[model samples]
Target chain A: EAGVAQSPRYKIIEKRQSVAFWCNPISGHATLYWYQQILGQGPKLLIQFQNNGVVDDSQLPKDRFSAERLKGVDSTLKIQPAKLEDSAVYLCASSLASSGRGLMSEQFFGPGTRLTVL
Target chain B: AQSVTQPDIHITVSEGASLELRCNYSYGATPYLFWYVQSPGQGLQLLLKYFSGDTLVQGIKGFEAEFKRSQSSFNLRKPSVHWSDAAEYFCAISSASKIIFGSGTRLSIRP
Candidate 1:
Protein backbone atom coordinates (compact mmCIF):
# COMPACT_ATOMS: atom_id res chain seq x y z
CA GLU A 1 0.00 0.00 0.00
CA ALA A 2 1.06 3.55 -0.60
CA GLY A 3 2.05 5.89 2.21
CA VAL A 4 0.43 9.18 3.07
CA ALA A 5 0.73 11.64 0.20
CA GLN A 6 1.25 15.42 0.19
CA SER A 7 1.43 18.04 -2.49
CA PRO A 8 3.87 20.83 -3.31
CA ARG A 9 6.92 19.44 -1.56
CA TYR A 10 8.26 22.99 -1.27
CA LYS A 11 6.72 26.42 -1.21
CA ILE A 12 7.89 30.05 -0.85
CA ILE A 13 5.76 33.07 -0.13
CA GLU A 14 6.17 36.63 1.16
CA LYS A 15 4.92 37.73 4.52
CA ARG A 16 1.22 38.66 4.40
CA GLN A 17 0.65 36.24 1.53
CA SER A 18 -1.42 33.11 1.82
CA VAL A 19 -0.40 29.48 1.44
CA ALA A 20 -2.10 26.13 1.44
CA PHE A 21 -1.00 22.51 1.79
CA TRP A 22 -2.79 19.36 0.83
CA CYS A 23 -2.69 15.79 2.08
CA ASN A 24 -4.05 12.42 0.97
CA PRO A 25 -4.04 9.75 3.60
CA ILE A 26 -3.60 6.06 3.15
CA SER A 27 -6.58 4.00 2.15
CA GLY A 28 -8.83 2.78 4.97
CA HIS A 29 -7.07 5.03 7.45
CA ALA A 30 -9.51 6.68 9.82
CA THR A 31 -7.32 9.35 11.39
CA LEU A 32 -5.39 12.21 9.83
CA TYR A 33 -3.11 14.82 11.35
CA TRP A 34 -1.25 17.98 10.43
CA TYR A 35 1.96 19.07 12.09
CA GLN A 36 4.41 21.92 11.83
CA GLN A 37 8.12 21.34 12.20
CA ILE A 38 10.41 24.30 12.60
CA LEU A 39 14.08 23.97 11.85
CA GLY A 40 15.96 22.03 14.52
CA GLN A 41 12.73 21.23 16.30
CA GLY A 42 10.37 18.30 16.51
CA PRO A 43 7.10 18.35 14.64
CA LYS A 44 4.28 20.06 16.56
CA LEU A 45 0.73 18.82 16.14
CA LEU A 46 -1.51 21.48 14.65
CA ILE A 47 -4.73 19.57 14.14
CA GLN A 48 -6.17 16.08 14.09
CA PHE A 49 -9.22 14.67 12.35
CA GLN A 50 -11.13 11.47 12.64
CA ASN A 51 -13.47 10.64 9.80
CA ASN A 52 -14.08 14.17 8.52
CA GLY A 53 -14.60 15.54 12.01
CA VAL A 54 -12.03 17.35 14.05
CA VAL A 55 -10.72 15.49 17.03
CA ASP A 56 -8.32 18.17 18.22
CA ASP A 57 -7.09 21.55 17.05
CA SER A 58 -6.08 23.29 20.25
CA GLN A 59 -2.68 24.27 18.88
CA LEU A 60 -3.98 25.74 15.65
CA PRO A 61 -3.68 29.50 15.28
CA LYS A 62 -7.29 30.52 14.86
CA ASP A 63 -6.55 33.87 13.33
CA ARG A 64 -4.14 32.69 10.67
CA PHE A 65 -4.53 28.96 10.26
CA SER A 66 -7.45 26.88 9.06
CA ALA A 67 -7.85 23.19 8.13
CA GLU A 68 -10.50 20.92 6.74
CA ARG A 69 -11.02 17.32 5.81
CA LEU A 70 -13.79 16.34 3.47
CA LYS A 71 -15.02 12.84 2.65
CA GLY A 72 -12.82 11.66 5.48
CA VAL A 73 -9.94 10.94 3.15
CA ASP A 74 -8.19 14.12 2.01
CA SER A 75 -7.23 17.20 4.04
CA THR A 76 -6.05 20.71 3.47
CA LEU A 77 -4.29 23.17 5.77
CA LYS A 78 -4.21 26.84 5.01
CA ILE A 79 -2.40 29.87 6.36
CA GLN A 80 -3.68 33.35 5.61
CA PRO A 81 -1.68 36.54 6.07
CA ALA A 82 1.29 34.42 6.78
CA LYS A 83 4.22 35.62 8.85
CA LEU A 84 7.90 34.86 8.71
CA GLU A 85 7.47 32.60 11.68
CA ASP A 86 5.29 30.42 9.49
CA SER A 87 8.35 29.27 7.66
CA ALA A 88 8.42 25.61 8.54
CA VAL A 89 7.68 22.18 7.17
CA TYR A 90 4.04 21.08 7.10
CA LEU A 91 3.75 17.36 7.70
CA CYS A 92 0.73 15.12 7.23
CA ALA A 93 0.25 11.76 8.88
CA SER A 94 -2.38 9.04 9.02
CA SER A 95 -3.09 6.01 11.15
CA LEU A 96 -5.49 3.14 11.42
CA ALA A 97 -8.00 3.20 14.26
CA SER A 98 -7.61 0.80 17.12
CA SER A 99 -9.12 0.36 20.54
CA GLY A 100 -5.95 0.76 22.57
CA ARG A 101 -2.19 0.77 22.50
CA GLY A 102 -2.21 -3.00 22.74
CA LEU A 103 -2.96 -3.12 19.06
CA MET A 104 -0.74 -0.06 18.60
CA SER A 105 -1.52 1.61 15.32
CA GLU A 106 1.46 3.67 14.28
CA GLN A 107 1.19 6.72 12.10
CA PHE A 108 2.50 6.89 8.53
CA PHE A 109 3.94 10.22 7.47
CA GLY A 110 4.18 12.00 4.17
CA PRO A 111 7.24 13.68 2.72
CA GLY A 112 5.95 17.09 3.95
CA THR A 113 5.77 20.53 2.40
CA ARG A 114 8.52 22.96 3.27
CA LEU A 115 7.11 26.48 3.38
CA THR A 116 9.27 29.59 3.44
CA VAL A 117 7.84 33.01 4.15
CA LEU A 118 9.98 35.95 3.15
CA ALA B 1 -0.25 19.16 31.05
CA GLN B 2 1.76 16.44 29.35
CA SER B 3 5.19 17.16 27.96
CA VAL B 4 8.30 15.48 26.58
CA THR B 5 11.92 16.53 27.04
CA GLN B 6 15.08 15.73 25.11
CA PRO B 7 18.09 17.38 26.72
CA ASP B 8 20.65 16.66 24.06
CA ILE B 9 20.64 19.04 21.15
CA HIS B 10 23.30 17.16 19.20
CA ILE B 11 25.53 14.10 19.58
CA THR B 12 28.44 12.69 17.64
CA VAL B 13 29.56 9.06 17.65
CA SER B 14 32.00 7.03 15.65
CA GLU B 15 30.47 4.72 13.06
CA GLY B 16 31.19 1.64 15.10
CA ALA B 17 30.55 3.13 18.54
CA SER B 18 27.53 2.69 20.75
CA LEU B 19 24.88 5.42 20.87
CA GLU B 20 22.26 6.56 23.28
CA LEU B 21 19.77 9.46 23.24
CA ARG B 22 17.83 10.48 26.32
CA CYS B 23 14.14 11.28 26.70
CA ASN B 24 11.92 12.22 29.63
CA TYR B 25 8.20 12.68 29.95
CA SER B 26 5.66 14.16 32.36
CA TYR B 27 2.18 12.76 32.57
CA GLY B 28 -0.31 11.68 35.16
CA ALA B 29 -0.99 8.16 33.97
CA THR B 30 0.88 5.61 31.95
CA PRO B 31 1.67 7.08 28.59
CA TYR B 32 2.17 5.71 25.11
CA LEU B 33 5.76 6.47 24.19
CA PHE B 34 7.35 6.61 20.76
CA TRP B 35 10.60 7.38 18.96
CA TYR B 36 10.77 8.76 15.44
CA VAL B 37 13.60 9.55 13.08
CA GLN B 38 13.70 12.20 10.38
CA SER B 39 16.21 12.65 7.65
CA PRO B 40 17.05 16.09 6.26
CA GLY B 41 14.02 17.57 4.43
CA GLN B 42 11.99 14.43 4.96
CA GLY B 43 9.08 13.34 7.07
CA LEU B 44 9.30 11.39 10.31
CA GLN B 45 9.67 7.61 10.34
CA LEU B 46 8.52 5.60 13.31
CA LEU B 47 11.34 3.77 15.01
CA LEU B 48 9.41 2.18 17.84
CA LYS B 49 6.66 2.59 20.42
CA TYR B 50 5.97 1.39 23.93
CA PHE B 51 2.54 1.12 25.47
CA SER B 52 2.66 -1.55 28.14
CA GLY B 53 4.74 -4.47 29.30
CA ASP B 54 8.37 -5.02 28.41
CA THR B 55 10.58 -2.13 29.45
CA LEU B 56 12.87 -2.68 26.51
CA VAL B 57 11.57 -2.54 22.93
CA GLN B 58 13.36 -3.08 19.64
CA GLY B 59 12.73 -1.02 16.56
CA ILE B 60 13.64 -0.91 12.91
CA LYS B 61 17.15 -0.22 11.72
CA GLY B 62 18.56 -1.96 14.79
CA PHE B 63 17.31 0.71 17.19
CA GLU B 64 16.06 0.00 20.69
CA ALA B 65 14.58 1.99 23.56
CA GLU B 66 14.05 1.30 27.22
CA PHE B 67 11.03 2.67 29.01
CA LYS B 68 11.54 3.40 32.69
CA ARG B 69 8.34 4.33 34.43
CA SER B 70 10.04 5.01 37.71
CA GLN B 71 12.29 7.63 36.23
CA SER B 72 9.72 8.78 33.65
CA SER B 73 12.27 8.25 30.92
CA PHE B 74 12.48 6.41 27.58
CA ASN B 75 15.89 6.32 25.98
CA LEU B 76 16.85 5.19 22.47
CA ARG B 77 20.00 3.20 21.92
CA LYS B 78 21.87 1.45 19.20
CA PRO B 79 24.55 -1.22 19.74
CA SER B 80 26.69 0.20 16.98
CA VAL B 81 26.23 3.39 15.04
CA HIS B 82 26.09 3.49 11.26
CA TRP B 83 26.61 6.44 8.93
CA SER B 84 23.07 6.01 7.63
CA ASP B 85 21.75 6.38 11.17
CA ALA B 86 22.59 10.09 11.23
CA ALA B 87 19.30 11.91 11.65
CA GLU B 88 17.10 13.87 14.01
CA TYR B 89 15.39 11.78 16.65
CA PHE B 90 12.28 12.77 18.57
CA CYS B 91 10.62 11.37 21.64
CA ALA B 92 6.89 11.70 22.14
CA ILE B 93 4.28 10.84 24.76
CA SER B 94 0.56 10.37 24.46
CA SER B 95 -1.69 10.73 27.48
CA ALA B 96 -5.25 11.85 28.13
CA SER B 97 -5.76 11.77 24.37
CA LYS B 98 -3.09 14.39 23.80
CA ILE B 99 0.32 13.83 22.28
CA ILE B 100 3.39 15.87 23.20
CA PHE B 101 6.78 15.81 21.52
CA GLY B 102 10.26 16.69 22.63
CA SER B 103 12.53 19.23 20.96
CA GLY B 104 14.60 16.48 19.25
CA THR B 105 18.26 15.49 19.09
CA ARG B 106 20.48 15.58 16.04
CA LEU B 107 22.90 12.71 15.58
CA SER B 108 26.09 12.94 13.56
CA ILE B 109 28.27 10.05 12.49
CA ARG B 110 32.03 10.23 12.58
CA PRO B 111 34.03 8.28 10.07
Candidate 2:
Protein backbone atom coordinates (compact mmCIF):
# COMPACT_ATOMS: atom_id res chain seq x y z
CA GLU A 1 0.00 0.00 0.00
CA ALA A 2 1.19 3.46 -0.79
CA GLY A 3 1.82 5.80 2.12
CA VAL A 4 0.66 9.38 2.23
CA ALA A 5 2.12 11.36 -0.67
CA GLN A 6 2.95 15.09 -0.83
CA SER A 7 4.00 17.28 -3.72
CA PRO A 8 6.94 19.64 -4.19
CA ARG A 9 9.07 18.33 -1.36
CA TYR A 10 10.42 21.86 -1.10
CA LYS A 11 9.02 25.27 -1.96
CA ILE A 12 10.20 28.88 -1.77
CA ILE A 13 8.05 31.98 -1.92
CA GLU A 14 8.33 35.65 -1.09
CA LYS A 15 6.52 37.19 1.84
CA ARG A 16 2.94 38.27 0.95
CA GLN A 17 2.87 35.75 -1.88
CA SER A 18 0.46 32.86 -1.93
CA VAL A 19 1.45 29.21 -1.71
CA ALA A 20 -0.34 25.91 -1.82
CA PHE A 21 0.57 22.37 -0.74
CA TRP A 22 -0.99 19.12 -1.88
CA CYS A 23 -1.48 15.82 -0.18
CA ASN A 24 -2.71 12.42 -1.39
CA PRO A 25 -3.37 10.13 1.47
CA ILE A 26 -3.24 6.37 1.61
CA SER A 27 -6.10 4.69 -0.19
CA GLY A 28 -9.06 3.69 1.94
CA HIS A 29 -8.04 6.05 4.71
CA ALA A 30 -10.93 8.15 5.90
CA THR A 31 -9.10 10.70 8.02
CA LEU A 32 -6.56 13.22 6.72
CA TYR A 33 -4.61 15.93 8.50
CA TRP A 34 -2.33 18.85 7.77
CA TYR A 35 0.39 19.99 10.15
CA GLN A 36 3.06 22.66 10.24
CA GLN A 37 6.46 22.00 11.71
CA ILE A 38 8.66 24.99 12.28
CA LEU A 39 12.38 24.40 12.47
CA GLY A 40 13.34 22.78 15.75
CA GLN A 41 9.72 22.29 16.67
CA GLY A 42 7.16 19.52 16.46
CA PRO A 43 4.42 19.42 13.84
CA LYS A 44 1.42 21.51 14.85
CA LEU A 45 -2.02 20.51 13.70
CA LEU A 46 -3.36 22.95 11.14
CA ILE A 47 -6.49 21.09 10.14
CA GLN A 48 -8.11 17.69 10.16
CA PHE A 49 -10.72 16.14 7.89
CA GLN A 50 -13.01 13.19 8.30
CA ASN A 51 -14.03 12.11 4.86
CA ASN A 52 -14.82 15.31 2.93
CA GLY A 53 -15.82 17.43 5.92
CA VAL A 54 -13.54 19.15 8.39
CA VAL A 55 -13.48 17.69 11.87
CA ASP A 56 -11.16 20.21 13.50
CA ASP A 57 -9.32 23.32 12.44
CA SER A 58 -9.40 25.32 15.61
CA GLN A 59 -5.65 25.88 15.66
CA LEU A 60 -5.38 26.98 12.08
CA PRO A 61 -4.77 30.66 11.37
CA LYS A 62 -8.07 31.23 9.60
CA ASP A 63 -7.17 34.67 8.37
CA ARG A 64 -4.34 33.30 6.21
CA PHE A 65 -4.68 29.58 5.98
CA SER A 66 -7.33 27.30 4.52
CA ALA A 67 -7.58 23.61 3.64
CA GLU A 68 -9.99 21.32 1.85
CA ARG A 69 -10.34 17.66 1.04
CA LEU A 70 -12.30 17.36 -2.16
CA LYS A 71 -14.31 14.21 -2.83
CA GLY A 72 -12.96 12.91 0.47
CA VAL A 73 -9.79 11.77 -1.23
CA ASP A 74 -6.96 14.24 -1.82
CA SER A 75 -6.51 17.43 0.14
CA THR A 76 -4.89 20.82 -0.31
CA LEU A 77 -3.76 23.56 2.05
CA LYS A 78 -3.30 27.13 0.98
CA ILE A 79 -1.78 30.17 2.58
CA GLN A 80 -2.34 33.62 1.19
CA PRO A 81 -0.21 36.66 1.86
CA ALA A 82 2.26 34.44 3.53
CA LYS A 83 4.49 35.82 6.25
CA LEU A 84 8.00 34.94 7.30
CA GLU A 85 6.56 33.15 10.29
CA ASP A 86 4.81 30.79 7.87
CA SER A 87 8.11 29.26 6.82
CA ALA A 88 7.93 25.70 7.93
CA VAL A 89 7.55 22.11 6.76
CA TYR A 90 3.98 21.17 6.02
CA LEU A 91 3.29 17.54 6.79
CA CYS A 92 0.31 15.43 5.67
CA ALA A 93 -0.91 12.42 7.53
CA SER A 94 -3.73 9.90 7.24
CA SER A 95 -5.35 7.25 9.37
CA LEU A 96 -8.35 5.01 9.41
CA ALA A 97 -11.52 6.22 10.99
CA SER A 98 -12.25 5.25 14.58
CA SER A 99 -13.18 1.56 14.66
CA GLY A 100 -14.39 1.33 18.23
CA ARG A 101 -10.83 0.67 19.47
CA GLY A 102 -10.58 4.21 20.75
CA LEU A 103 -9.62 7.29 18.76
CA MET A 104 -5.91 6.55 18.81
CA SER A 105 -5.40 5.00 15.42
CA GLU A 106 -1.94 4.92 13.90
CA GLN A 107 -1.30 7.74 11.46
CA PHE A 108 0.88 7.46 8.36
CA PHE A 109 2.79 10.58 7.36
CA GLY A 110 4.27 11.94 4.16
CA PRO A 111 7.73 13.34 3.50
CA GLY A 112 6.26 16.88 3.86
CA THR A 113 6.62 20.05 1.86
CA ARG A 114 9.19 22.48 3.20
CA LEU A 115 7.91 25.98 2.53
CA THR A 116 10.46 28.78 2.79
CA VAL A 117 8.92 32.25 2.75
CA LEU A 118 11.53 34.88 2.17
CA ALA B 1 -6.36 21.79 26.49
CA GLN B 2 -4.11 18.77 25.84
CA SER B 3 -0.41 19.13 25.22
CA VAL B 4 2.82 17.19 24.95
CA THR B 5 6.24 18.16 26.27
CA GLN B 6 9.74 16.99 25.42
CA PRO B 7 12.27 18.43 27.81
CA ASP B 8 15.41 17.66 25.82
CA ILE B 9 16.11 19.61 22.69
CA HIS B 10 19.10 17.50 21.76
CA ILE B 11 20.96 14.48 23.07
CA THR B 12 24.24 12.85 22.13
CA VAL B 13 25.08 9.25 22.88
CA SER B 14 27.90 7.00 21.80
CA GLU B 15 27.07 4.10 19.55
CA GLY B 16 26.08 1.01 21.51
CA ALA B 17 25.20 3.11 24.55
CA SER B 18 21.81 3.01 26.18
CA LEU B 19 19.40 5.80 25.29
CA GLU B 20 16.50 7.45 27.04
CA LEU B 21 14.36 10.40 25.85
CA ARG B 22 11.81 12.01 28.08
CA CYS B 23 8.18 12.98 27.36
CA ASN B 24 5.38 14.43 29.47
CA TYR B 25 1.75 15.28 28.80
CA SER B 26 -1.14 17.20 30.33
CA TYR B 27 -4.66 15.81 30.11
CA GLY B 28 -7.47 15.17 32.53
CA ALA B 29 -8.45 11.73 31.24
CA THR B 30 -6.59 8.62 30.21
CA PRO B 31 -4.09 9.56 27.54
CA TYR B 32 -3.23 7.88 24.26
CA LEU B 33 0.50 8.22 23.81
CA PHE B 34 2.80 7.69 20.81
CA TRP B 35 6.44 8.07 19.89
CA TYR B 36 7.53 8.83 16.34
CA VAL B 37 10.93 9.12 14.71
CA GLN B 38 11.70 11.29 11.72
CA SER B 39 14.81 10.85 9.62
CA PRO B 40 16.17 13.95 7.98
CA GLY B 41 14.13 14.73 4.85
CA GLN B 42 11.74 11.93 5.66
CA GLY B 43 8.35 11.54 7.19
CA LEU B 44 7.57 10.65 10.79
CA GLN B 45 7.42 6.93 11.55
CA LEU B 46 5.62 5.42 14.46
CA LEU B 47 7.90 3.90 17.05
CA LEU B 48 5.30 2.80 19.54
CA LYS B 49 2.09 3.70 21.33
CA TYR B 50 0.32 3.11 24.63
CA PHE B 51 -3.45 3.04 24.92
CA SER B 52 -4.35 0.79 27.79
CA GLY B 53 -3.39 -2.19 29.94
CA ASP B 54 0.37 -2.30 29.42
CA THR B 55 2.52 0.46 30.80
CA LEU B 56 5.63 -0.61 28.89
CA VAL B 57 5.49 -0.80 25.10
CA GLN B 58 8.12 -2.10 22.69
CA GLY B 59 8.49 -0.68 19.23
CA ILE B 60 10.40 -1.08 16.01
CA LYS B 61 14.16 -0.52 15.78
CA GLY B 62 14.57 -1.87 19.27
CA PHE B 63 12.87 1.10 20.89
CA GLU B 64 10.78 0.84 24.05
CA ALA B 65 8.78 3.24 26.17
CA GLU B 66 7.15 3.08 29.57
CA PHE B 67 4.09 5.02 30.60
CA LYS B 68 3.97 6.36 34.15
CA ARG B 69 0.60 7.72 35.10
CA SER B 70 1.83 9.15 38.36
CA GLN B 71 4.46 11.25 36.60
CA SER B 72 2.43 11.78 33.44
CA SER B 73 5.51 10.74 31.51
CA PHE B 74 6.30 8.36 28.65
CA ASN B 75 10.00 8.06 28.01
CA LEU B 76 11.50 6.22 25.02
CA ARG B 77 14.51 4.00 25.63
CA LYS B 78 16.85 1.79 23.69
CA PRO B 79 19.07 -0.76 25.35
CA SER B 80 21.78 -0.38 22.74
CA VAL B 81 21.83 2.42 20.27
CA HIS B 82 23.11 2.42 16.72
CA TRP B 83 24.32 5.25 14.56
CA SER B 84 21.30 4.84 12.32
CA ASP B 85 19.14 5.73 15.30
CA ALA B 86 20.12 9.36 15.01
CA ALA B 87 17.00 11.32 14.14
CA GLU B 88 14.31 13.60 15.50
CA TYR B 89 11.96 11.98 18.00
CA PHE B 90 8.54 13.31 18.87
CA CYS B 91 6.10 12.44 21.61
CA ALA B 92 2.42 12.88 20.94
CA ILE B 93 -0.88 12.66 22.74
CA SER B 94 -4.32 11.99 21.22
CA SER B 95 -7.25 13.84 22.69
CA ALA B 96 -10.64 14.81 21.31
CA SER B 97 -9.85 13.16 17.98
CA LYS B 98 -6.69 15.22 17.48
CA ILE B 99 -3.06 14.54 18.19
CA ILE B 100 -0.70 17.07 19.75
CA PHE B 101 3.06 16.68 19.45
CA GLY B 102 5.93 17.76 21.63
CA SER B 103 8.67 20.07 20.43
CA GLY B 104 10.83 17.02 19.60
CA THR B 105 14.31 15.81 20.59
CA ARG B 106 17.18 15.59 18.15
CA LEU B 107 19.33 12.54 18.70
CA SER B 108 22.96 12.54 17.66
CA ILE B 109 25.28 9.56 17.57
CA ARG B 110 29.01 9.70 18.25
CA PRO B 111 31.52 7.17 17.02
DockQ for the candidates, in order? 0.53, 0.64
Per-residue lDDT tens digits for candidate 1, residues A77-96, read 99999999999999999888
Q: What is the interface RMSD of each candidate, in Å?
A: 2.8, 2.3
Q: TM per model?
A: 0.96, 0.97
For model 1 chain A, give the 10-residue run with minimal summed lDDT: A97-106
Clashes by residue pair, model 1: none
Q: Best candidate per DockQ, number?
A: 2
Clash totals, every prediction = 0, 0
Docking level for model 2: medium
Go through the candidates in order and give the C-alpha RMSD of each one to the true structure.
Answer: 1.6, 1.3
Model 2 C-alpha RMSD vs. true structure (Å) is: 1.3
